[model samples]
Target: MTSTHKNGLSPASVETIAGLSAGLISTIIVHPLDIIKTRLQVDTSSHPLLNSSRAVLRDILRNEGPTRFAALYRGLTPNLLGNSAGWALYFLWYREAQDVIRNLRGYNLGTQLTSVDYLAASSASGILSAVLTNPIWVVKTRMLSTSATQTGAYPGMIFGLRAIYKTEGIRGFFHGLTPTLFGVSHGALYFVAYERLKEWRKVSKKDQTLTNLDTIVASSLSKTFAGTLTYPHQLVRARLQTYDPGATKRVKGPGLVPLIQQIWRNEGVIGFYKGLFPNLLRVVPSTCVTFLVYENTRWALPRMFGNADDDPSNRTTVARKGERAL
Candidate 1:
C-alpha cells in the first residue's frame, strides 16, 4: 500500500507537485532562450538576416515594435502548460515505475537501482509524457514561428488551439510526435548518467544526501551529454511542427521521411545541428535549475506539509545512519 502523508498526498503526488514547481521555475527562467532556440531551429532559409542570435533578436525587436521585449515570450502560455504537465506526469510515472521495479527486485529504500533500471523507467516515462504533452508543444511552436505583427498570427494559446483544430483536425496537434518519441532516448541517457553520477558521489563522499552543488553538476553534465546526441531530433521536430504544407507551395508531403529528405537535400549534416548552440545554452542552465528545484521541492514538501516518515524515499540519512550504528 502506498503511504499517505499528513497532508493526504501520496509519494507519487508529491513527486508530481515537485515536478510542476520545477518546470514552472525553470521555464520562467529560460523561456527567452527557448524562444531564441526555437526560432533558430525553424529557420530554414539562408537569409543573411537570420544568420546569428544577434540577428534574430534584432529582427524580433524591429518587427515587434513597442512590445519588442514582450514578444520574446510569445509562446510562454503553451510552453508553461506543456512543460509543467510533462514534468509532473514524468515524475509521477517515473516514481511509480521505480517503486514497482524496486518491489519486484525485493530491494529496500537504501539499495540503489541499477543504471539499466533507471534507463528503462526514464524512457517509458519520458515517451509517455512526451506523447501526452505534444499537442501543447505544437501550439507553442506555431506561436513561436509566427510574429505578432503577422496578419494571421494566433493571438493566444486558445486561439491557436481553436485554429489548428478547426483547420487541420486532430492530426494537427500531433505534429513532430515521431521525432519526439525518438527523442525519448535523451531522457533515458540523462537519467541513467545522472543516477550513476549521484551514486558515484554518494560512494565517494560516504554520504547519502546530495548537496545542491552536487545536483547542479550531475544535472548539467547529464543534460549536456544527452542533449548533444539527441539535438538533431529537436531540430527535425521543430521543422516538422512549424511546416504548414497546405499554406506553403514549397513541399507537397507532410510526413517525417519527406521532411528529413528536404532538410538533407537543403542543408546536409549541418542542418541537423541548427540552433544547437542556443539549445545548449538554454538547456544547461534550465536543467540545472529544474533539478535543483525538483530535488529541493521534493525534500521540503513532506517536511512542511506532510509527514516526512511517510516517504520511504525521502527518509533522512541521519536516521539510516543511526539505525546502522545501533
Candidate 2:
C-alpha cells in the first residue's frame, strides 16, 4: 500500500508531533513569565494584595531581583517534560480519533479536517492526558506556587513530588483535574480556531501556496486570539490545581460550582481572573512559539524522512513510541 494509504502516521502523528514540539519550545522560551503568572495566582497573603498585578510584579522584583527570574522557571524540568508528554499524547489520541471520525463521516483528507472534528479529537486527547499526567502537573504546580517555608524546605521538583505523594497520596496529584480539563478545552478551541483561520487566510488571500512560515504565523495568531478570549478559565484552572487542600482554611475542591463559590467568597469574582494579565502576556508568546515550532518541525520532518508514503508504518511507529516517552 502507498504511504498515505497505509496505517502509518494516520494524520494523528502530524498533529501530535507538531503540538509536542510547539509546547516544548514555547515552554522553554516563556517559562519565566509562567512563574510570574503562577506566583500571582497562588499568593494567599494579605501582604501581596492580590488586586494589584503591578504590585505583585514589583514585589517579585524588589524581593527576588534578577534572582526572581530563576523563579520564572521554578518547575521547568517537570513542566517541560509534562507539557511535552501531555501535548504529544493529546495530539496522538486526537489524531487517531479524528481519523476514525473522518472515516465514518466520509470527509476527504485533502480538504482539511473540520473545526468540530478538531474539537472532538482534542477534547478526548485533553481528558486522557489530564488523567495520565495529573501527578506530574500537580507536582509542578506546587513547586511553582509555594514558598520555601510553605513547602518545608523542599527545594526542587523531585523532593516536591516525593513529599506530595507521601503526604497526600495519589489523589493529591489530581488536585485540579476538573478545572484543568475545563481549561484545556481552550487547547481544543485553539487548534480548531488555528486550523480554520489558516485555511480562511489562505483562501481569502488567494494564496494557495502557503509556507511553514504562513502556518506558524496563522497558528500563533489564532491561538493568541482564542487564548485571550478564554483566559479566565485558565486562571481558574491554575488556581484550582494549585489550591492547598491542607491549608488552614482550604479553598473548595473540584467541580465548577464549589470552585466558583470558594473563589468568590475568599477573593471575590475578580479573583477568578487574578493573574489574567500576566497569563495573557505569557500565553500569547508561549502559544506563538509553540505553533511555530510545531509547524516548522512538522514541515521539516517529512522532508527529512522523504515522502509520506514510503515506510509510513515505520514512521508512525517511531512517532508513537517517541510520543509515549515524551
Candidate 3:
C-alpha cells in the first residue's frame, strides 16, 4: 500500500479511521465468544475454569436454546461503540506519535519506523484509550454478566449507564483502572512484536498476498504472548469490575491489592488465569481479524477516499518511495 495518506491526511488520522473500521468488524464477529469468555472468567462455581465454560454453555444452550442464545449478545451495542471509538483513537494517537518520532529522528514520511517507535506509540495510545473508555467496559461487563446469568436486564446502554451512575457514582465507571493500566503493556508488547515481525517479513522479501497465513500467525502469536504475560492483570480487572452482593464480606476494604490478595488466598496462583482457554480461543482469531481488517482498510482507504495527488502541498512535497515529507 502507498503512503499517500501519510502525505496529506496525516498517517495517524487515516490509521484512526482504519482502526475504527477494523474494531467494529472484529467485535461483531467475535462478541459471542467474548461474552462466553467473561461468563467463564467471573464464574465462582467449583467446576474447573475450562469445564465451567463448557457446562455453562451447555446449560444455556440446552435449557434456553434460542432465547439464551439470543441473550449471548447482551452488551454488543456498547461493546461495539466503545471498541470502535477506542481503537480509532488508539491508532490515531499511535500513528501521530510515530509521525512525531519521524520528525525527531529526521526521518521522512514513508520511512519504516522502528519497533521502539511502535512501542512508545502503542503504549501511550493504549493506556489513554483504556482510561477514557473504562466506563463503557464496566457497563459492558455488567450487562454481559447479568444477561448470561439471567439476573438483571439492562434496557439499553443508557439505562445501564444510569443504573451504574446512580448506584456507584462517578467512581463506578473506573472500577478496574489499575489492572487496565497494567494491561497497557499488552498493547505495547503486541504492537511492537507485530510491527517488527511485519518489517522482518518485508525485509526478507515476503510480503506475500494481503491476507496470508503468516500475517495471521504473526498477529495471533503476538497477542498470545502479550495476553499470557499479562493474563493475571486481566483476571484481577474482571473480578474488580464484577460486583457481587457478598463481595464486601469476603474481601478486605476496596482496593486492587485487597482484591489481588483475596484471589491469591482463596484460589492460589491458578485464580489469576481463569478462562485462559476460552479467552485465547476468542482472542487469537479476534486479533487476527482486527489486524487483517486494519491493514486492508488502511491499504484500501487511500485509493477509495483520498485526493492527495491533486493537492498543492502533496505536489510540492514529493519524497522518495520510502521517505516521508513534512
Candidate 3 accuracy as lDDT: 0.73
Model 2: colliding residue pairs: 3-309
Most accurate candidate by lDDT:
1
Ranked by TM-score from best down, the candidates are 1, 3, 2
Runs of candidate 2 exceeding 4 Å displacement: 1-17, 44-51, 62-69, 148-153, 243-256, 308-326
Residue 132 CA error for candidate 1 (Å)?
1.2
Q: Which ten residues in a row have the lowest lDDT in candidate 1?
A: 317-326
**What's the lDDT for residue 107 in model 1?**
93
lDDT of 3 by residue, 1-326 (tens): 22454335545555787799889988998887787777766765445777777876776566542486476677898899988998898977776676678788998766777778888888888988999999998888877666544445565788878877877789888888889999999999998888777656556654322234556878988989988888888777877787653232223235898878887887887778887888888889889888767766565555456644423122112122332211
Candidate 1 lDDT, tens digit per residue, 196-279?
A: 887777667755766777777888999999999999999889988884523622233458888889989997878888788878
Superposed model 1: Cα runs more than 4 Å off: 46-51, 243-253, 312-326
CA displacement after TM-score superposition, residue 58 of candidate 3 (Å): 1.6
Error at 154, model 3, angstroms: 2.5
Clashing pairs in 1: none
Model 1 scores a C-alpha lDDT of: 0.80
